[model samples]
Target: MRVLSRVGCHLCEEALPVVDRVCAERGESYDVADIDADPVLVARYSDLVPVVFVDGVEFATWRVDPAALDAALRRPR
Candidate 1:
């Protein structure tokens, strides 16, 4: 799982716990990348900074929820 987020974002802060729980439950390797660290990412994700992806596919954005993430993981890619 990968999380793209920027600094001082309330939504991003909220999403962190959900991702942490999910990765723990699934024993998955997860990483959070600050979009502001890269210019290209900043441009592409500035408006969608709080996006989360599981195995490279977008799973959620703007907001994150446990149930929604669980469902996305349960879904076949």
Candidate 2:
């Protein structure tokens, strides 16, 4: 999984820990990228910081629900 986020974004701040805790609990690895680091990413996700992707597919945005994330992680992929 990956989190697309930006500095100074509270929603991004809020979402990261939830991702971290849930992923950690499940032993699932995840990464975070700043949208502004790449122009295309910035263009594509400027308004969608804190976006979460599971297997390169969008899983959630803005807020991450722990139960939902856990359930998704548990699914066979």
**Please, what is the whole-model Cα lDDT of each candidate in the order they appear?**
0.86, 0.94
- Candidate 2 local accuracy as lDDT? 0.94
- What tens-digit string does per-residue lDDT give for candidate 2 at 1-77? 99999999999999999999999999999999999999999989899888999988999989999999999999999
In terms of lDDT, the best-performing candidate is 2
User: lDDT by residue for model 1 over 1-77, one digit each (tens)?
Assistant: 79998889999988898889977886667889999899999888899869999879888888888988877777776
At residue 34, give the lDDT of candidate 2: 92
lDDT value, residue 51 of candidate 2: 95
**Candidate 1 local Cα displacement, residue 57, angstroms:** 1.0
lDDT (C-alpha) at residue 50 in model 2: 86
Which stretches of candidate 1 lie above 4 Å from their native place?
none
Candidate 2 TM-score, C-alpha based: 0.97
